[model samples]
Target: MRPAHGPGGAARAGDLPVLAVLYGRGAATPLGLTDTARGRCAVVFLGDLGDPLVAADLAPVSRTTRVVDTRGLTEAQLCALVVGLAPDGVVTFSDSLLRATAVAAKACGLPFHEPDTADVLVDKFRQRRALASAGVQSTACRLIRSAGDLAPALAATGLPAVIKPRAGCSSTDTCRVDSAEELAARYAEFTDGVTRPRAYVLEEYLVGDPSAVGDFWGDYVSVESVTRDGDTRTVGVTGKLPLAFPFRETGLFVPAELPADLVEQVVRLERRALRALGVREGVTHTEIKFTPGGPRVIEVNGRIGGGISDILKRSSGVDLLAHAVDAALGAFDPPEPVLGLDGSGRRVAFQYLVSPPSDACVPGGDELLDDLYDIPGVDLVDVGITPGWRADWRAGTEWILGTVYGSAPGFAELRITLKAVQDRMASFWSEVEV
Candidate 1:
């Protein structure tokens, strides 16, 4: 990989800035980013060990790696660690650690989403209230603490409501329950087992534009923007593939092909949503839907869109990971991403590898990896689950067999590349054993 040049273009000798980061999955992505920004790494680990793939990268690049379970510590203790590390900036890309990172960034007086607002961004219930209170046009939502609350919540939101943990990402445990019985059962799974947020949120369902089906557009889109000192700048909007029902994201196509008017409308709605959340600094991923009535906000995340960073890099000539480092250091102010529509424009996408229903038998095995890697236009592949892991379809993103990243000269070509690979994988799935 080529060394990433900083916002200043280059770094002088003895100019290795240090950054303290909260370690999470894909730590290498961020660690490499800091290195490209001409900086050293220091990691704060929540678990006893970091993700193995990331740990390997962290070893050589990180100046100091501490295993501090911030979950057990108070805000002051976490703050002390940040002040003691005394790095130039602090950050974490993990949705699970955004609030902690924001708190530490605040204690260190670094540029990040303000700690108070960060909490609101992490909690969907709070996020909904904030958006609606600010007149941002959001769905009516109810917080559910137990099974007893399900009926009332359901009645309030009507049928086909969305249920999810108050705080989570990757669409984990998110589902659309159409009946009261299914709603109660789903709520029980969370309350009785997962040990997640004490309360889950039930929200009125927002449908997508009826005409979007033929365009292959998902029910919603996300605006990847950066906020600097209370000002927000749009990076690009992403067009999602049909979600894997209930709510699993299959893929994302960047520089979404939307009419000029709709693009402006989305940008304006995103700006209003972010302002309501008080997201004054750092990057944000805001998901919005084009409902029959108008655009409605789905949710806002105070970080970069996870795997879509590659798509952004390819389609817009912007390295969002590197841009994140620039944001942390208070030196980021790049113009909005420039997208092209001609065949000359770059088109990139990421397709998650997921299994069919568990009872379904499938074929192929370790050999499938080779086939995926051999596919043309496939640039990167990461399998979260190893062979013989007993794929469980109910595990949400946890069941992700892997992901394939690829790019092409235009959206049409990109779709061909992705479809070819996906179809090949499907063939293997049909013959493999469960």
Candidate 2:
């Protein structure tokens, strides 16, 4: 990566600080976000009531909270609404709303990624262009909107390249194509039978170091960072469990048991990437992999990583979610992540996602989950799959049936605990009949 490089606010009712959150099916729930801002400030949720995703995104509304419905409002109207709220700060956890939040924040004179930066943040094609233009990365990337574009994209990116929605998240409709024929097929599969074809990005795949990660772990890691007024602090490097199918994440642990040198290397690259992306404030989740050439960036997320807050709180007692709230409020005092603390009896904290096998209906139930609690080192089990539901690989990572949170003394111990859990959990999933 290469180097590259906001606010208004006022107290509202009760003379307390306020955080204006553009809420929907986003990173943190209303309940979860409200909890984070409880003592620090008051939270006002700006709900896009017209969006279908918001119905599931919102937890039950509480009496004390106010949900502002911004559906059918123009961008200027939304900004005016935010200005009227007079919040001390503004923030968003949803990828799709980053730009809208930025616009609103700007209207209210609060700190946030600028609208221009947010544009690049949400659009992969623009981000790649910015990264390469700034010498952060020189990876070849092309945006394709039709079947005719696939052959040229494949020719430019070469075999074993990646094809994913240019502006999508959670790896939905993502695939790896190793040949021109495969690329064409995947392109058709993604575009055919749909009224309007989605734009896609084709880029060279960065190879990972299998030896560096071992069999049970994925070949990548994520650097969780907090940037305040352009001064970024490294929170911690997170390691991953092996991926499911093409690219579904299984497990993630913090205080990633990496050597001091490698950890520093990862942090350095992360800082550069953040700078290249013009991130001046708020929290970021930057994924990187150990390549034979060196550490390379996967992508940079402008919000807290999914399932990361739990592991981070467990590992270091750091409330990353609160950091996002505080950063928006311009009152965040982030602590440098405690490094090399996994020695002696120190433990590694992890969040394990349980995804069902493709083309199967899981026999999941409350009683079936009860057996998971007894596994040593496994702290909590939360599975939402009903007795009969399909799990499709095409559904991507959102196809989660359950999640397992736990801690172990080290990587070796964590592996044993994970295997024990997976082995037992396997019985809950029944293969589909042909």
Candidate 3:
């Protein structure tokens, strides 16, 4: 394979220069991607606001790579900033930024990944329809324009459905309704300018074990490889546990503990869905559910998933971001599956933060960390929440409180370890005062 190169063809693999743009702080996409890229990269942060915590995360890598802050620049101005860097390639974690970056890159005649892939990933309604056509069984969904259309949409798809914005990410603007009355009430919340019609998808709700949520609602389970021509190859499987509610991803464990036969089924379904979506290449984060009969797709994101990739790296020691960067630079080849960390000696768990109710104040940061660290086999604790950051009650779009990570000798031990972690967290929250 040819060495990975920058736009100017000056840098190569083991020495390739890369540029990553992040939309906001706590965005694992660019950070993970940059880590996978090793030290041969630079990062350009684009946003109106900045976070010191995020800057701290990027600080260690500042020695070898440039970190440009362009919070005040317009999109055009940002484009100029990016071009001036003369990066061999540019990558972004936000779909909106991806769209803007793609346009600017194309205008400058620089190589870039397909912009449609970002749309396919960010727009839930469009993603579902595309996957459905590919023979992937997905939730019936429609993009609703106004509250008036909610009734008709419900009539078409049935009740107990999910209402979400078309362009929404991270479960933002998502509502699960059980009745027409509930749907209307939710619609009213949107109508009052509390929620904008940025585009929304109302979907049929599938019932299943919450523990198996990712399997039930995810668009695909098999890890995929896409080419510049839009060809996809299913490589491996990932499993997700249920989020708390409304929107809080709990954790994702790699080498999904599913049976071998079931894993194959998920791979087949994912392949079909990727083809249907016209996804050629790059990383895809697809969620799938395993029904009594077989596996069905929930949704597909044309980019690598947030926590899963991180888990995969910890479990398998293979770097997905580097692979993606190589592919974008036209020097990547499909990789062989590296056997993840052996299950005999250890079990791994990746956790996301979920805040308690708003009326209830969570425990102080130090106390919370202290409790998590008390869990057996605890290895790392990444707390994203700060004093001023908003906290939620019940699971909602803003529920990532903090992550508790650890490993044990086996699954049972791992469960005990994680349970202890949870118990401590619960105790901490319960004891704290608002």
Indicate which candidate wins on lDDT: 2
Which lDDT tens digits does candidate 1 get at residues 1-434? Answer: 12322222242244445556676653225445544455333234432133465455455544433344344566677778677656677777777678778888888888998887989988999888888898887577999887778788888899888898888777777888889888888777766755554778999988778474345557678898887788777878887776665576677777776777888888899999888889899888889888888788888988887666777776667777777777787776665564445455455555544544333544466567667777677877765545555544345665566667776666677667777776877666653443
lDDT of 2: 0.80
Query: Local error of candidate 2 at 225, Å?
Result: 0.9
Q: Which 10 successive residues of model 3 have the least lDDT summed? A: 1-10
Each model's lDDT:
0.70, 0.80, 0.59
Instruction: Give per-model CA RMSD.
Output: 5.1, 5.1, 5.0
**What lDDT score goes with residue 66 in model 3?**
47
For each candidate in turn, the TM-score is 0.85, 0.92, 0.79
Candidate 2 lDDT by residue in tens digits, 290-312: 88988888888888888788788
| Candidate 2: worst-modelled 10 consecutive residues by lDDT | 1-10
From the highest TM-score down, the ranking of the candidates is: 2, 1, 3
For residue 399, what is the lDDT in candidate 3?
A: 60
Clashing pairs in 1: 362-431, 362-432, 362-433, 363-431, 363-432
Error of 1 at 276 (Å): 0.9
What TM-score quantifies how close candidate 3 is to the native fold? 0.79
